[model samples]
Target: MSVRARGTLGRFLLTLLVALLALGMPLAPANADPTVGPAQDEPLPVTVNLTKITPTFADSSTPVHVEAELTNTGDETITELWIRLQRDQWISTRAQLQIVDDQQPPYAWAMSAPTSLSAPLDPGDSMSVTLTVSRDELVMYDAGAYPILLNVYGTVDGWENHVGQAAFTMPHADQRPDTPLGVSWVLPLIDQPRRVSGTDVFTDDTLATEISSGGRLENILDAAEEYGEQAKISLVVDPALIDALDAMSDGYQVRTDTGNIDGAGAEAAASFLTRLTDVADTSAIIATPYSDVDAVALVRAGMPEVLSDARTYGADIITDVLDTDPITNIAWPADGIMTDDTWQTLVADGVDTALLSGASYGQEDYLESPLGITESASTVLPNGRAIVADPGLSRLLTAAPQYAGGPVPAAQRITAELAMISLQMPTEARNVVLAPPRDWAPSEQLLDDLFTTTTNADWLTPMSLQQVSEGPPVDRGPLQYPATLSEQELPGNILESFAAPLQQVAELGSAFDPEDTDEALWPTRAALFDAASSAWRGGDGSAVSNGLDTANDALATLRAQIHIVTPSDGTYTLTSSDAPLVFTIENNLPWDVHYRIGIDESRSVGLTAEDVGVQTIPGGTRATVQLPTSVERSGAFTVVAQIRTPDGDPLGNDVQINVSSSAYGTAALWVTGIAFTALLALIARRWWRRHLFWAEERRKRADAQAHQLREDAGDHGQHEYRSDDAIVPPDFAGYDVPPRDEHR
Candidate 1:
């Protein structure tokens, strides 16, 4: 407690501390060599920006951009930075996906593009790349959800270094809108008029282009080269002046020739017209300014699909189904001439078409319907030496010179306009839309195969690729002689053309609404292109969830009339409150579907049990129960309709409903028996408990008697049982000999 004592204790503690420090510290003779090697072992500092994911448009071959930001964290100078993204091999499957990169191929068996890019990052810098996907692909083995490791390993001050890795995702891969885009295949009609160049003549490679934006020179060169390779197009002139083409006010419509024609020409034209009738069911062919009319008249001489011009268009066998209108188009910039002010005034004038020469009209000589789009990044057509058609003149031109006597209805015009526009797309699932296809084939029948939905997705399209019956195009010849061109070597490379279209489509990058192009536009632009494509129908941001209650009401009504049956032969009878009679739809999983519906022997209209329903599914999503008709229809007793899923599982969701009027139903006596049986079980349980208690008492008494018998039967020599842990106590007199030897 004294001050002196306290001082002594403090001194002792200080001495102890010094001794401990000496033991743990690095020890060496006064001066030794410093530790060898560089001062820092940690890699140049690296930071991966998880937020910079750049989005690509929906339906674009390219997918969402999984962007990154890298910064040098170490003092060492970073040079030749190499970044690598590896699919979490531990988590992702070898089957479910396709990864497109030099490092990782999209499909396991296919080659992927090189993903490594070389760059130098002075202590702090960044770079980016994009990955593409579709609505179906996004769900099956989605890139957005997959664990991705981006490792940045490169040379740092002459030594190999790894910048470490940061986790990131192409979050927008499915962020694309579910909004159905109106996509349609523009097929060039089988035959119109094709120019046959005997010597394989082609346009000059140096022809000037008219497309206003992007890389026009490169595009024209590419298109020309593609046509040359296919040997499908002919060049009318060296490049055919396109300068005034955009400026022109109207397009020319060719018709059948009305005047007399030579014998050979007549037969050929007639054969051509007859084939046309075979496809579209036409009555006759009208004459054109360059007509060989006698030929058309001869062709109209006979055929079943077509009728003479004087008669009806064709056979009326389609009486059962109402005929649909034809799709139409109007050529724009009617003439091959225009001024800069021309195209600028088009929006104000309500015109919607344009024509361009030195462009892709499929094969140049063919009368293919083409849509003229302004191309490129800086489409400067309206600026310098170029001229564009005034919008007002374009509209005027379409009504007269463009169509002339052609039968293009106004409604058809608007429909075509509605078919081609594209909007922003997010990479999320909500933004992806799937439209079911009734069948898969390449023909006009494809149009009817489209699925219509109340969902935001608004259109349908058929793929342009035709399945070649393991061979080349069939020669279903009319045995006709078409136009011939001078044999001049065309100037373009086929390789450049095909690749260029894909490249051009890619270069579209991101287009913005003229007014909102700055950083401030991110919120609104994000909203428009983000995944809520179906949910948010407009700029106001209305959600689809709000209308679900009404959807429930609709569901209730629909459920009432559906048909049910595992198979019409099954014995289980199912009854519901509002069933009259219904039908069922079935699907086969992963393959085709089988549908069977039982029909009433008496009613003989509409679809019957023989009719099978088709299921339209996109990859991972399951086939749904779709109501073919109202379920309230009451009819004769019937059990029908069933289809399996792509996985071969049974789903009666597609089944129809039927009335079950008490066929061998349950009885009230069954309920009474169950109640009495429970009471009897409770009584038996109590009796068993009482018996067990008495049995335990008898066993205890017997055990005690056995113990007493053993002691009485034997001498039971004196024995001591003492607690080894406890000390023995001595009585007042000396107890029998204790530990101090009694003998001693």
Candidate 2:
């Protein structure tokens, strides 16, 4: 091969082998190291990250350990790599030097032998190394924070430079501030209880496991056990979860998609509740409103009644269930943002404090909230106080350790940042608050390591909410919340729209409740609150939407049960007008319902009857009501049946009946029969009178003829002998000439 071609082949072959090493494959049997190929402005083809620095504040006697990880970012294999720790006395603090020049330091601390890489690191491959500086070699004369740099020297084809820095503190005479660094570690022990459709029963065992022996909840318990009464660390809890556990204490049925299953999760949940109560006794417990209600949304949706109920009554409900007095005067809205109206409403509802986001304090830059500045203060509302959490510190405290090189490294970074806060204000002590992520999932080991590091940090003095509340306040800007309230408004409107029927259900169920504490209806109320949970953050809003759908389904079912029962075809028939229009009211609900049944005026059918006032129907029973209705010449008519609450609010849907009345009334038949009898008698009398008159006329005629015959018998009396032997004339059967002469 030509020289140039051979060189290209050599580079390609080396890269191929390094790729294999990155994939944990065997390398090719070629000269692994080649002479320097080309020069670039950036020396090293590797990235060195100083993962951690142990003993951040150490004396000469304490061993100084520097740990870092080096990754080969270049395509070629890293044939040689070395890490060196350097110290510069000219730069006492971390902020002094922004850039590192090629100029050598004026004063250099004693150097240790560079830690060598164990094996060649392939491209995209990383190796961790620990560099140590012995106490005999390094000495510290002053007590202050010092800047230390990790210089990485690596060779691909030639040597290159990569660098990072960390701060080290050597306390003066091992002395921290006499007042101590006031710190507040707020741990959130919250879980959104599962709200499945068509159920008031607590059934999921996974929830139980999460609160059981080795779950995330157990980590908080362990912290509580370790921290004892260190007043500064607080625990914020969701009451809905506690209520769910209380319900699950007995054998419970967990709802599944297909059906329900008998679950053993409740036992574990009960155990967790007991443990939580114990923790509450020792630590400050902040009970959130049941299900973490979305106050802003409720206010925007014009549901001040619901918002008031959640804030004012949640504390009592939680206390009764948990048997512990949690701080209920404080309100924590979702995303820690509430509009002015919502805030004022909460204040009116007896909320004295509100936990808000840094954004509420006009701090758009999450991490830049002024801690040491005297002007850093919480805003004051009409009847409440708003405390803005340091968003940066809160994020850093809860940041996943893996994202920041591991727990220890992340902890060290946290310590360094905290130390800088004190360093910035050596004479004054400031209160720093740390709120972990709302839905934090921490490993036991990680939690232990973090708490150990934090509690032992000489500069930090952990304070509880009670203690922090007593501290001096800082001056802050006006209250500010996110302009968008649509998310909250939508769900709130949904709940409001269904509120009346739900309230009726609650009242109805409560009446029949054997326990009489409203516990029977609490699950449904909790579900409504669940549907409005602020935990439904950015996304498609499926969580809240699903919750709303579930609630609507439940309410719809409840309303359906208290309705006018009709045929499958939704029609009714009246065989007789006398048979009062009778229909059945089916109360499918589990409690008695007092409802009024009446005709809908909008119907085309004319029906008249006394109003069927409120009737109490026992739950799960069917009752028939007979309404005396008069149909006006009806072959077919539409009867619109209305079912309503005692207050006249519509329930369910209006039932329509196609009624056909085929029976006649008795009074009208009697009157027609009497009139027909009278007319028949009158006609018979007239016929009798006419017949009598004709008979009499005939008799008179006969007598007249007999007299004539007597007079004529002497002359011609043959026709006068007998009435049956009458002679007939040709024109008039007797004597037409004689009759005519008599008439004349």
- Quantify all predictions' global Cα lDDT against the true fold: 0.27, 0.61
Q: What is the lDDT of residue 637 in candidate 1?
A: 44
User: Where does model 1 exceed 4 Å of error?
Assistant: 1-152, 160-178, 184-329, 332-352, 355-744
Clash tally for model 2: 10
lDDT digits (tens) for residues 1-744 of candidate 1: 875576456545544553465355322121111111122343226655432332311232444344455666666667666654433221122111112111221111111122455667676455553333332223222322332344456677797655544432222122333444322111111111111111111122111112222223222223323322232211111101111121111221122255322222223223322332332322111111010011121122221111121011111111111131221111122122222233333322222322222111112221111333211101123211111112211232133112211111111111222221221222111111111111111211112111111111333221111111111221221111112211111111211222322222122112212232222222221111111111122223222222222223322232222224343654323342222233333222222222233334344322233333444433222333433322222233444444432333333344333433332122323445677787777777777777787767665664455444345334333322234422222232432444657533
Q: State which candidate has the highest TM-score.
A: 2
TM per model? 0.17, 0.68
What would the per-residue lDDT of candidate 2 be over residues 1-744, giving only the tens digit for each residue? Answer: 985576456545644543444354211112211111232355345555555566765655666787777777778877656665544442333333212111223223433346777688888888888888753334333444443445556555574433222222222223455445566777787776574533546535667677766687777777777874653468888777776777677667877788887877766877777877777778888877777777787787777776676654567766887787778777777767778888788777777887777767666434233342322224555665766666656655555333223454455545654564555555676666667777776666556656776687677777766555556655465677655633534444355554654566555552333553254355456566777776765445566666766666665665676788776766566666555777788877667777777888667454454587777788789999877765544466687888877667666578878877675445444566788888888999999999999999998897786667566545543433545746332222454355656866
TM-score, model 1 to reference: 0.17
Q: Deviation in angstroms for 196 in model 2?
A: 2.3
lDDT computed for candidate 2: 0.61
Question: How far out, in Å, is residue 555 in model 2?
Answer: 1.5
Displacement of residue 331 (Cα, Å) in model 1 is 3.7
User: Residue 643 of model 2: what lDDT?
Assistant: 81
Clashes of each: 89, 10
Name the top lDDT candidate: 2
